[model samples]
Target: MRAMARALPSLLLRLLLTSTPGALGTNPGLVARITDKGLEYVAREGSVVLQRELLRITLPDFTGDFKIKPFGRGHFEFHSLSIHSCELRGSALTPLPGQGLSLTISDSFIRVQGEWKVRKAFVLLSPAADSKTRIQARLHGSFDVQVKGITISVNLVLGREPSGRPTVTAPGCSSHIRDVEVDISGDLGWLLNLFHNKIESRFRRVLESKICEMLQNSVTSDLQPYLQTLPVKTKIDSFAGIDYSLMEAPRATAQMLDVMFKGEIFNRDHYSPVSFLAPVMSLPEQYNRMVYFAISDYVFNTASMVYHEAGFLNFSITDDMVPPGSNIRLTTKSFRPFVPRLARLYPNMNLELQGAMASAPFLNFSPGNLSLTPLMEIEAFVLLPSSAKEPVFQLVVATNISAMLTFNTSKITGFLKPGKIQVELKESKVGVFNVELLEALLNYYILNTLYPKVNGKLAEGFPLPLLKDIRLYDPVLEIHKDFLFLGTNLQYVRA
Candidate 1:
């Protein structure tokens, strides 16, 4: 008994997951939950700033091989025998190709103070340092430079390999640098300053090539691996689980990044066959960041199939269900109990109620009348004392179900209500007596037992997928021709 109790949830879970028409094989369903067709991830300026890592660079030593003779007095050859480098402190960046960015560096300077030699022609140099000859050359200044022509792009892919994670790939890109200017105050400012324009131009070309290379390498090599793997499954106790899968890679635009994915809220042990209807992405820009998803009939049908196979459609009315003051009616024609009450007259009689889905649920997403209808088969049987396992009397009824959808805050909620009820007497069997009033009892059982259960399960709608360190708010739903849209704003909070 204890072992059965422990295994009950697992059994229920296994039944909840079956197979769809297209997905009937092993490990069928997609592994990720897709919201708004996929993950419509938009990292604004704030997110970019918070996540940007620091950068550092080291330059090789420079050698001055040429000689400089000012006013034909004496010849001076300056040489740098040590290493020199500069650091780019911080940067402000924008998206898209051919955009502009600004970089600033404090305490930035280049110094090449070393030995110098001066040779005179007939010793006619006016200012000659023959006793002690030294070369003092230094150019130190803070820089506020602008870079342009930068282009960035990312391609996101999802799968389950070493782990269930999405991967991003970025190709190598380049840009041109212009408007390079630097201030200088050093000993060689007078003679060395002659080539200021030439120096700036050379630096611009080197800086542009270096920055582009760094950006491409970092995005493709470092950032790609970090974003490739993500935890996409949610655990709902030991019986149920919610899964998410990416339908395709994410595409980037001028303003935002768009991702496509699909999601499932079903049992852990059972699999439901589902067809993905890709939704159009028109992420409304009413908030800083938002996501939208369109719920389709496929999702509803998949949920229903999983529920049907989980044994939730079948129920029983035991002998203990008799009212305290009144006995259960033995005859189905009217509410008339047999003489001497049911315990003595029909001691071993019990009622068995069973329900099955005749067809998949139909979802119509019209303007105001977004309704879901499903057809089902319901059966009732009376177990006599002689036939302990089999039924003596049975009745089959067909029921038409209608459920209305409404919004409960960010989640979509549904209300279950039974519609037309059709009694199928051909498939129904009657033995000892015929009860005309059994139809009403069957209808009551369906509305109170089956339909409400379905509705309540649906009312516990799928929650919105969330990002790390971000709070989502005001999730809104919109219905379109191909798919449904779920939009919500994102707010970043400090942890």
Candidate 2:
């Protein structure tokens, strides 16, 4: 169209001259231009509005095409036309702006914004038909479009914006269901042998299951607010992110026979929330584990959970696995009785209930039960500074533990055991934990048995047969503590 209108100020001046930040945080200025209202995009079988008949392809030959109509005024006309762009040079493309990509366009639709590394720069439409030989690969991105807001950076590595949350096991799970269904058995070769074979060969090599479920429902709507900060009672009904980005369709034999993945993990406030919320459980492999697109090896994770419990429930694949590649193991099944009339009808006076019961197996990489939410004011002190003569006894305590960053922080540091005072926690600038090792963790937690508990009145360390009573095993009665922790949500919080 007049060469896309004189290449719209040379692609918004190459997105204002490649935007910047390029050290690693990689922003590269993502530039744009060619507005007048155009480019509305969408994938997975719907939405399209292009221009200049171009959405083409590149490399050994994957073939391509995308052209739209309606232009001038309200505006329209989009294209990506690629017959072959010299094998996508650097790889990954998107609505990268400041350097080039803001895309808003409307008629049909177009939104896909930026940042978080433009997530493989959107545009992953693969039906598969070009491979005379050309896989050296290198695409890089910035094929953006935005109308009202004015951004049109489109050179066409061809795109950006695209992007798994799977783990649902509720003892009985009751409320919260808007409509979700996924039931499958063995297809993508049994999910390429159950999430193996390098994550089902990188989810069919990214491209087309409606453009990887529209980038796994846009990374399951951006990780449902960090899975709503976990811990309520574990019933998270749904949460998605599965953009199998085309899934390398060389031939395509079978994939959706009800292979699960319907989608609905709503906005729960909680009643018993133990949500590993399953929707197709692939949340972009927790951020690009090659966008994990394992199409079908095993998809049947039925969950309804809500107390009335059991135990030994662990699925598989989160890493740490070694030998020949662990294809899902440890299957036990639990949670069946815990409706104490819904825990006495919602008894959450700032909740704590997890003191003791008998249910403790959970170990696959531990880190649970722990809790804390101190992004900035965490001071765990116990100073004894005054050492000149004696009476120096001080202790400082704090707790706001917003509940160990969403379920299982190494078993919540194993129930926060780091307190025991008598003296020398390394000479006390702030007695640094391990003073009598909190008396051997208070004899295995209030006397369950790590031994020890004598003459301080059935309590306080040193009992287990009085270690030959060498004057109560002297060495200057040592003890101390210093754990100034103010940690919260283990990383990332710009807002």
Candidate 3:
């Protein structure tokens, strides 16, 4: 056995990981007890946040429900028992402070089912809306509950706000996200009513708001000012969801985003781009729902895809002069280097990623939950040479791509000689190269400014960058996804 261990490669060693307490694939359901306990449910449903942990959860009953074990029948449910990252984070016993809670999770699964109900109780929220306040959360919720092996199902309820209050509630909140409602007892002005207060220092709140506000300003001032009117011109746009309303200002929101260049940039004149409909769908249905309902802070009413820069990628271009319109397939078999973009969207608190990110400004604070690897995306664009007669090149869409690629020809009208291709992104620390990094790097190629001398001409061959060039961009081999997005300037090269 010892000699066999000696022959093992480092990859196996990493997979071995630190010896956790449990046996290999132990059923968490085995740890359940008959005592009361505190439970915090952090679940997302499409886009709503639900925070109400019910009573009990035990695998003693229920059919088709897979319990904490896979090899076994693995079917169970619980209440007043919230589970986080598999193990119990914390819980609030209803009516009475409960004791031990049931915590079960399957690492391979994306959703957890639950059944639950609540008795009489009142949850008073003292939202510290002071300018210096921020809101933090400690919750307990249950998807379902059980009493003596029977499922006690309950419908999620949302009571009407008092008639006098102007509740600005938007639809589509993420389900798994638990939003805390703050009820201020005193009268306050509009400006002062903007935020909730946490126990953190006063300066902390100011800093966060100030930073987000400053970012808002920087977008408007810097990136948007220089964009010209037509390769279909418009200077102002958004990046990383930050609005940069530069030049002859367009409306502030997507509802108002009129395609002014419509009938003009047609058919062959269009800049055909195959982009990702990439939904940040991995988020727990609860959190996804919570983001939809309760998380205005995480999203915005004026959300627009003004622009998104992805990279700081270090993936080496193995072959020089990759043929144009040719897809560089990175399958788990051919290219084990590719990472998935799913995990980068709804990052969990843990999970260290390694690879590259174009920009990773706030990654240190919170790593998003979007994590998946061995995935594929389709992002292709063309740079039309600036001649009265447009160039017609055959685009052979490559097969064997890892993921689905959707194209809406209307959104990206034809591209004429673009002066400079501006890609704004941040760098990743390799937390999950899995993809967000590669996705970021691809920006340098997709509709990017072709070699200025290449002068917006679509190169006839593949445009893969030399592997060495990838390294110079401050590649991150280990880090999270949120902070990855960097700014890049790439001139088209026909290599």
Candidate 4:
């Protein structure tokens, strides 16, 4: 599982770098939104408090037999010992992706200044108490437990329980315990004073062990299961999967950590020849809080392929669809008023219109406009009343369309808006037949109905690939010769 976890990000990165932009857009860029959630820390003043909270280090009351050759034997029971005040210096944390975290914590000193009472204790070879009698005892001591240089390192790896939730596993924990000085003052004080060196040596070892144990337990209990799955949930409405991968290790600077990534959209149905050979660039440090994207033309081309495969580009204009009072006036020498009626007299006088791209659609991104131009073949066919099935009038019109793009943000998605559509005809069969009839119907349907229908379809904008709970801000967009740049601030959407 750990090896698989390590390899998943690499696989995702390959997909992102290899896939070319298809029907989704000309360019599909990665969405790297980093937040200070899993790996976090406090500094200086607040860190000490955080450390204290994480490891209270409250030792239970222990009663046991204390024996030494020179000091003799005694039954001793000690009261609870706890750390009261501490000086926290600083802390740092680095995340290990799916594994866990590496933590480094510092503290100037931890003052374990608490009262400890030992009762029913007696020492052999001592003048104050008899050897056979387990005399009742009372002792109070103040100990200054100090760590030299006060640097602690811990590595917490994550493991799962039976319930599938994540739990922390402390693989390594190291803390240096420099000195423990005990000032003994109480009944039978001479016995303690005599064995003080041995007592301090034993206490230091125990304290070090307790500190490590307490930290492991505390951190494991406090760690949350937030790094389970990193998903890019958004995609074009028609696209099925995400193509994204980490470009390199996360780059940490003074103020923020930047995760450099690359992504592209893919279409299983549409094959694209474009290649993304550009090297993954370093993250720019200009914006502290930003998401930067660069979209290529392959994404847009793939989306066109998907639309064509789905038969969305094919449309029809029937007799009933023409406005009630509208007329198709032919401009030939024998032009007649009833020609429009005669055109509609067939079982269904309709133009079987089909639009197809002559070449891939070109998407140009600018400050406000996202324009698309697809060289197209718009064919119109009219069926005669006398003909069985085939149309008597067949004409192919070559044209191109331009439109402005708009977009809106939803709870979990952002999609494009296609509006302000304009169609420009490049070539048409005008003088061959009654071209006026075909032209009138094309204008009436293409502008009045087809454009609106296309707009309606476009209102369901392409969903930008992103993660859930993320909110993208207004983007600062820029266009270059080969790519488009989009940068925005991002955050978790507030409930």
Model 2 per-residue lDDT tens digits across residues 111-138: 2211111111123334585324322222
- Give the per-residue lDDT digits (tens) of candidate 3, residues 174-266: 112122222222222111223323311232332223323332333244213312211232211222212111112111121111111111111
lDDT of each: 0.45, 0.21, 0.22, 0.51
Q: Whose lDDT is higher: candidate 2's or candidate 3's?
A: 3
* Native-structure RMSD, model 4: 10.3
lDDT of 1 at 65: 28
Candidate 3 residues lying further than 4 Å off, grouped into runs, are 1-393, 398-495
Q: What is the lDDT of residue 191 in candidate 1?
A: 45
* TM-score of structure candidate 4: 0.56
The total of clashing pairs for model 3 equals: 164
Model 2 alpha-carbon miss at residue 447, Å: 7.4
State in Å the error of residue 159, model 3: 15
Better by TM-score, candidate 3 or 2: 2
Model 2 lDDT at residue 460? 16
lDDT, candidate 1, 1-495, per-residue tens: 999999999987676665343232222122112232222233332224322422333222222322345433333333332213333222222223222111222222322223333343332323565453444333332222233322222322222333334564334344454355543334444444454465456556655555556555665666455454333676643555555554444434454343434555567796554544423333334333244444554455455555556656556654344334432333332233322232343454565555565654556554434555555555555566666554333445554455565554434566767775766543434323344445555565566666677666767765444445555566665554433545655565645
